[model samples]
Target: MMYKSTLSVKKEIALHLLFWVIWVYFTLAVVDANGIHFAEMDLFSSTWCITYVVTFYVNYLFVLPKVFHPFKWIKAIAGLVVIFLFFAALRYFLEQFLTVQLFNVQNYNPGTGILYYIYDNTFYAARPIILSSAFWLIVLLVRLLDYNKYIIEEQKNTEIKFLKAQINPHFVFNTLNNIYSMVHFQSPNALPAIEKLSSIMRFTTYEAPRNFIRLGEELNYIHAYLELEELRHYDKSFVSWETTVQSDNHEIPPYLLSPLVENALKHGSYTAEIPIIIRLSCNDQQLDFEVINRIGNQKKDKLGGIGIDNLKNRLEILYPEKHTLQTTEQEGLFSAHLVIYFQ
Candidate 1:
């Protein structure tokens, strides 16, 4: 696989849980002013846990978003005001409940201490908001990653469609036009060339849709295409194609290399007097190929790649940071150079 999935959600959750555990410990220590040790108490008491859940649900699901996002400012602030009064009444009753549970009395008040109100309402309530923010941040990251994956897939599909569209007609038109020209010239080898064309089309139409193909199969397709080119231009000056592929067991994206040769035949050897030379050299880890052609009056556009920008885009999107493509123009002749990662 060219793409690897990134960090998962559970890992992020575990990390957040660790941070929250530490913060809760430190927060309680600060609230107690070192008078109580967390190691000696059950922090998950019903009163504490209920309050935690309530604050977390309200802030995470409603309050913070209403405060932070737009158009809900007035409504959210008003809701917070109502919530503040409700909490004031609720805290008054909850203290009575705790008094009954732990002290056998339903009437008591911890009054005239500003710290108690600030600690209970403000800092403690902020816990769920903080935790949900972390979770939502992870959600945002995952969504962005998924969006990027979608974009890459779209670009790849478009590139493949363009390459398939460009090369199919280009190769066929050249072959058919060659046969058409040969039929008038009374060449004896025209029928066999057409048969080779059939084989080439068979592979393309049947197999090229696959994502990966054996290097040997791709090279065979190249050989079939080159044979058709040779048959079509038998009378043209000597043009030689030599492919010395080192490794055959690996797989690569199909039809990626065929366009280079097709371009060479279409443009490089358009004229009869000058020969176009193409060679494929490969190692266990890399494939290097080059095509050189003589410029002619009616030459196909040397801007390159089978009449579509798809080839360049494919090489870049699929093999970027792994492959290299360079085009150099010198002495009225043009060449396309490619190095594809093989291993």
Candidate 2:
């Protein structure tokens, strides 16, 4: 794509001019002012000659790629210098045959002798050698750009994999903590909590590893976990969740909503009076997932905890240029808003 884009009308005109300039300059350096070719026309008028364009077209279109590719550094700068030097030598031999035989113009007859052959050929060498050397430099720069793109792509993949791995260990740790709380309290509801834990565990272990899932299925799993949290802290605390969307079962990335809801519960103390709100809404091209909790002044330090930091990293890696995450901490409210562009 870069090759095609760079080679355009302007560049073609420049190459045409450059070719004639090179031809005239090199030829004039060796030939006298009263030479037969010089007598035919001066530089300005000679540029208009029909043979000039044809010579340039054949040289640039055919000879350019042949010499250029041979001179290119497929390896490194040292390789480029070495290859360009070799291709320059090869170019001299090619010029000897091509200028005499390829063009075959009627008026441009030359004496057939070996030393003059080598001299004329060697004289013609500079233009192609310089152009091919320039081409080699371009190839080296392109190679470096391609290498950078490869590294960035690999790094992106690694980060996505890390975000996918993040959720399950968090789920395990939360469930184990719940079980510990149950064992300590000697609560009769522990068995039922264990059952809810099993359902969530089964889904997270199986379904959440996938790239995407049905919104309905994810909502059902979230509902199950929320019910378990309710059962666990019912006598001592309060929590609530609400969800609305344009579609019933649209597909989205798995575990997209889990981290936000989990962070709300993870940070807020069990003794807060008001219910925590985890409201989620989605339209055709946008999703707004917000978590609102009331924290006393002393407990406000929980705002930038491990879970929220992980949440930010996951969003950055996943969306990069699309999603927006903002956290606001005012007098009594700690809230986070996540706006995702689903389109």
Candidate whose TM-score is highest = 1
How close is every model to the real structure, measured as TM-score?
0.71, 0.62
RMSD (Å) of each candidate, 1 decimal: 5.5, 9.7
Lowest lDDT block of 10, candidate 2: 43-52
Q: In candidate 1, what are the lDDT values of residues 1-343, reduced to their tens digit?
A: 3544455567656865786687568755444566756554452344555565565556555665566555476875685665454444455456556556776654335454646664566654555546655555565578678779877787778777777677667767777887887788988888888888888788879777777888788878877777776776674344666779667756777777777766666666455455667778878779887877765557553755554366777677678788887777677677888888855
Clashes by residue pair, model 1? none
lDDT values for all models: 0.67, 0.64
| Model 1 CA deviation exceeding 4 Å by range | 1-45, 61-93, 96-120, 150-158, 180-190, 270-274, 305-308, 341-343
Q: Which stretches of candidate 2 lie over 4 Å from their true place?
A: 1-123, 126-147, 235-237, 270-273, 296-298
Instruction: TM-score for candidate 1, please give it.
Output: 0.71
